[model samples]
Target: MALAADFRHRYVTPEASLYAGEPTRCEELAELLRHILQMVDRNTPFRHGAYREIYEALHGFLHAGIGGSAKDGLVWGVKDFWAVWESICLVHVVNQNPGDILTCDMEHLPVLLSAPERRRAWLKQRALLFARNGIRRRPDLVLAGGDDIKVVDFKYYAYMRQQRRTAEADEIDKIEKDYLSMEAYGLLLQNHFLRNADARANRLSLEFWLPGAKAARQPSRQQPPWDPPLSVVHLPAEDLLRGYVALYPHLRLMR
Candidate 1:
């Protein structure tokens, strides 16, 4: 029931170090609030068995050659959004299946950021300010289709079970938020790689997967079943922006 110790990658670059640290202030506070909310919602499954399955698998893959692996059991809690993101990316991005992967080297861009200090400054200026921000949480795969560049983040979470039967009254307020995040990323892609006047046009598209196991139990208030098919959500530029705006304030506090 204790929070997990930080498991950030050890091979942190100066940019990465600066990037991660910058979000701590406001994001930490927002997280404290979220934690309190979760405590009040005891019926909620903040951490579940599914999360542990994905985390351990991913930890194994990351440190397989380094002589380490994730511990057994749920290695992450429900609030640990990154764990879910990584899970989706591993299947869709790294594996490069149904989704095509873009292989451009993104690290080289910072070299042209005038001075190292300028790169840091640019990141701070553009960092997201909202809940579930992805400025530092870069996805695993970049997909290019026609004129669009799609970024994928994997996720897993239990929405309100009662909402399954009663629309709006019981279920979580599912909206077009995911699309908004993708839009923000699209804008970022355009600004960073395409719209810099000197850069090329890279119209980016972002997408994600929320894979859920089919429920073996009967549908009921206590043991609601997962949706029959996998719950896959895709967001375009406009939708992504909305999600960003909605979550931006809490997100900025992190930075």
Candidate 2:
């Protein structure tokens, strides 16, 4: 029995500064996300009921036995360890990666399992090139999925909307102006993760799942008119990237 039980350092070092810096650095991205979330929050307000139910159910389960589940109070902000681990596990099962899976929270994977370790290895192998300059915007999920690396943004919305200019209001071309609202997130992920990393396959996948709807639009029944398909306009990845780059310049003035 090699169990040493002598206590040494007691208090946990509070890292308030790191969290405090998150807001100012990611103001622009947060603002854009807030804009989109506002639409879901206000117009389709009733849809949030389902999200609340899920959050409550998960919270109850975690509090009942699982201890490490951090509670933030806000329905949307609740960080359940099980949810995160399940997501990682699902990806691993589908991808069939040999590397172990790991997370920041140690309690989430206390068994020292091979899968968790493989997951962590995959994450570390990514050529993560993040710019820590003017304003910092860290990607929500940064990890390597075997051969190719993935930078993902976990978006939780009640409903997705398509905004058009009203008859009396200004003529705003939201769809044309932006290809994909998520493109900015893609660019941000690239700037932070892929750029200056190892010589690996760099691909960014923006994972968004709404409370009432799937993250992206479903595939169409008929064939498209264009090569890549016009329905892709629905995805609008380029639009999102453009928006992010355009907003990047303004980040310096945000403070």
Candidate 3:
């Protein structure tokens, strides 16, 4: 009770309050945040890290407002959404802790990261120190723990939709490209990263997370036809579509 009263007194007070211009809770909270940031001392190392985490939390909160509409603060265009998928996958890791391998029977695919490791932090689009054709390789998601560096590339492969059409030469070409890219990611990390020198290729575990039919059987080992210790994780199309609808409810229900 005292705390609540103190908060109201500090933040909600207005001596000559104008009835026509009362401050919204959102604006008031933002003002409070500005005050907090101004007061925070960034000189101390430990406190600086903690302050940084708090800033990220605030940024995330403001990135999307209370209402889930267009007017609700910052939003992204849906041109290329693999980045969004990468974020969602990271959430699954942070929330569910899928460990190194996913269970055969699971709604969400397991993440290559472990619980303690996931809690530390998951990175996004960190540029690898390798480049081909003057373009540096930046994987979608990355996590490092001890001798292991786990990397995941989210594929908006659209297999569920693509299955309707017959495979053609171009499709084969695309698949080959994707596999080769995954292989390159493993190699790039091994070259610069010195932890697992003996088994350079095996040091980093890379996987392409793709959407697939529930009827499709989960392979005990890696998903197939390609060889290179590459892995494939099949997330349910129904759930993925459901997630899309949750984010944008305009599209008709998936047939």
Q: What is the C-alpha lDDT of each candidate?
A: 0.38, 0.36, 0.48
Q: What TM-score number comes out for model 1? A: 0.30
Q: Candidate 1: list runs displaced more than 4 Å.
A: 1-85, 97-100, 103-137, 145-147, 158-181, 196-203, 212-255
Could you tell which candidate, 1 or 3, scores higher by lDDT?
Answer: 3
Q: Model 1: which ten-residue window has the lowest total lDDT?
A: 104-113
Question: After superposition on all CA atoms, how large is the RMSD of candidate 2?
Answer: 20.0
Off by over 4 Å in 3: 1-84, 97-125, 128-134, 145-147, 160-172, 194-201, 213-228, 237-255
Tens-place lDDT per residue, model 1, 1-255, is 123223223222334432134557435544543454444445555657876555554444332322224322112233344453343233233223433444321231212213446435434433431113433534334555555555554444333122232444554344334434444555555556633562234344444444334322222232343211112443232333244334424433543
Q: What is the lDDT of residue 5 in candidate 3?
A: 75
Sort by TM-score, best first: 3, 2, 1
lDDT of 2 by residue, 78-126 (tens): 2343243333333332334333221222222223223445545434533
Whole-model lDDT, model 1: 0.38
For all predicted structures, in order, the TM-scores are 0.30, 0.31, 0.40
lDDT of 3 by residue, 158-240 (tens): 55221212345545566666655667766666665554355534556766677566624332253343333455667775675
lDDT minimum window of 10 residues, candidate 3? 101-110
Q: List ranges where model 2 is wrong by over 4 Å.
A: 1-66, 69-127, 134-149, 155-158, 161-185, 192-203, 210-255
Give the Å shift of residue 1 in candidate 2. Answer: 45
User: Each model's number of backbone clashes?
Assistant: 28, 23, 0
